[model samples]
Target: MDTNNFEETIKPFFWVAHKSSFSVCLNAGSYKPEIFETREDEGFEGNGYDWGSLARVFLDERKPHLAEYVRFDPEAGMFCAYSSNPESLKEFIVDFKKACEDDAVINDLFSRAELD
Candidate 1:
């Protein structure tokens, strides 16, 4: 993998951590988890920072092969995974989407990443 080139292609996203849940915005896009007030049941006691770390570990273990491209920014609650091979990236995204649907924590982070 071309580390320098891969780093150059990384896209940064923004997210907002709420008391329990969080929201993400992509490329100046609208904030997701928009109906925050109504999602009280989805809220957790932990903060976004903690969730970010959890997300990092989850993805690392869940898709060990993609470890090289997966990165997590706990401070911003942002996650990025990039690869020169579009097919590989697409495969990872598909697996990740399945994971998100199955795991709540991953779902939260994935939703915030705005990957879909």
Candidate 2:
């Protein structure tokens, strides 16, 4: 897809949090699709949020860039995904990835998944 199309497709997946406290880029590449959500930690200070660490105890190989908030679920044998907003991560990411695919943006982004 052209650059314009690609941008429009991913618009929903990108957002500025806290006036640019940080920028989050959520992209779903080819694989078993998953979801993520962010939660508010009441005990913490302003915007108290935390996404647990990405576990790598048993991976055949490690992809650090693609392994944020990624964890191994002993029972499932798959990664347990997390999100900046865990509560809305799954649904938001699904739609976000779909939007990119629908616009043929995935082809362009597949190569850049490492940057995500």
The C-alpha local distance difference test score for the whole of candidate 2 amounts to 0.30
lDDT tens digits, residue span 2-91, model 2: 334544554434533444132334332223122112111222111111111112211112234333533322122222333454324333
Estimate, for each residue in 1-116, the C-alpha lDDT of model 1 and write its tens digit. 34344322332333334464333323321222332223335553233443354445556667777666544443333344444444445445455544544556565554443211
- Minimum summed lDDT over a 10-residue window in model 2 is located at 44-53
Q: Please give the CA lDDT of all the candidate structures.
A: 0.42, 0.30
* Model 2 TM-score, 2 decimals: 0.25
Which one is best on TM-score? 1
Clashes of each: 0, 8
Quote each prediction's TM-score. Answer: 0.38, 0.25
Point to the candidate with the largest lDDT. 1
